[model samples]
Target: MSERPNYETMYILRPDIAEDEVETHTNKYRDLVIENGGTIIDNQQRGKRRLAYNIGKHREGVYVQLNYSGDGKQVGPLERAMRLSEDVIRYLTVKYEGQHSSLGRSTTPVAPMESSAPRQDRDLVGAAAAIPAASDDD
Candidate 1:
């Protein structure tokens, strides 16, 4: 029998958003998962907190979490939706293999894992890429 796949995604919503708008944004992500044939295991609200630094000039956010079961193929659509959503300030989805991904999605940092990869845009390019053209009179 093929093994089932489970994944979890955490995202932050705009703190200034109206209550009705919050529900709309939350439902959007939920529907995305449902439409993709994935089961939503849980939807958690972590509440607002002060940002470490300003994000869009906002000091707080409505944090949320989603636990789901889906194959590798489903990850992309969910990610794309999050990216396009102005209401969602940031999102990160990680596959919790073997371990139970039961907790509500929150803004808190997840425990570091060993072999997973980081996104390419997060990397620092070499100095050569950063160096400007050497203008010269010499």
Candidate 2:
């Protein structure tokens, strides 16, 4: 039987590198995942964008997100690659929770998640939940 899948991992890369370098770095990790017997659900390029704060003297970066299904072990090498890669200035990997779906399957492409900026979803939810009830001022 196939091993049970765990969490999803996504990361960003430094844009200052040549475009080819981006492809190389991305491919390397992809191969690593495959070699480790994991299935890659989606490998997405979120494109370049300005950073909210400086990371390793970088003002912007080429963001990438990987939606994968694999054993927990794959997370370490995924992160190790990020650390060793010179073209990647910053990266964060989050584990999806509570019946979460793996991002985009092969047949369908979902919109890339925005990187290097604030996410609106959290704020929107907070705002909606904080609405005050109407009061009888009169």
Candidate 3:
């Protein structure tokens, strides 16, 4: 068996669906991923929000995000299910390239060096000071 790769999926559902039906749809997709040999790390329901533009005449959608680990072959079926579902307005899946922290974020934080003034700013200031001021005699 191939090693499982980390993946994240975000999907938007039709806003007209009831809360209970939304839960059911969410569970259905989760189960589909698990059944296809994926292990879910996290699942988040972002709730209803307005869409950027009209889709199938929908002005709003309910967003859900799922993080999991699975082999490359598993994605096709999962995406197919979403594509065929009438309630799904849009969906996207992304494979993570490198190691991720427990919450799927980068473990290392990039920090800028502490200084009174950055090198570029200091150079600009010095250049301005070097220019001689104009006089009325000239």
Candidate 4:
């Protein structure tokens, strides 16, 4: 059997939706992922926030993020369901090569580069004297 890859999905829902409905929607998608042979590692609802610009005439949206592990075939059905839902404003899924500690967060730190060569200062006056200047007449 092929190994499942890690994935993260972030979706936006219409802000006008009821609070109870938000939980319902979140649970629905979580169940969808599990039903499609995927494991839900984490899920979060960021609450309603004003959009940078209106989407589908909506000025605000509720952000939802989910992290899971699944095979390639499992993604299509979940995405399709999101697409068909009128409550969903937008959604995106990204597959990651390696494991992540948390959704939208990176734990590793980058190493600094080292240079082998050292810098040296030179006499600009001597270098300038070595080159001859052109005459204006020429």
Candidate 4 residues 8-118, lDDT tens each?
889999998999999999999999989988898889998898989999899999999988998866688888989999999999999876556754664455579887887
lDDT of 3 by residue, 1-138 (tens): 756788888999999999999999889989998998889888889999999999989999999988888886668988999999999989999987555565657555769879897467788889999999889996
Pairs clashing in candidate 3? none
The 10-residue segment with the lowest total lDDT in model 4: 102-111
Where does candidate 3 have its weakest 10-residue lDDT segment? 98-107
Model 1 lDDT per residue over 1-138, tens place: 776677888888889888778778778888889898888878877778777888887889988888888776678898998898888888899886554534443444568878668655534566557878887878
What is the lDDT for 29 in model 4? 92
Q: Summarize candidate 2's per-residue lDDT along 3-100 as a digit string, tens digits.
A: 46545566678777788888887798888878877787677777898888888778888888776677767778888988897777877766553334
Model 1 global lDDT (CA atoms, 0 to 1)? 0.79
Compared with the true structure, all predictions reach lDDT values of 0.79, 0.74, 0.87, 0.86
lDDT of 1 at 17: 86
Name the 10 consecutive residues with the lowest summed lDDT in model 2: 99-108
Sort the candidates on TM-score, descending order: 4, 3, 1, 2
Among these predicted structures, which one has the highest TM-score?
4
Q: What's the TM-score of each model vs. the native?
A: 0.69, 0.65, 0.71, 0.74
* Model 4 steric clash pairs: none
Per-residue lDDT of 7 in model 3: 88
Which pairs of residues have clashing backbones in candidate 1? 65-105
TM-score of 1: 0.69
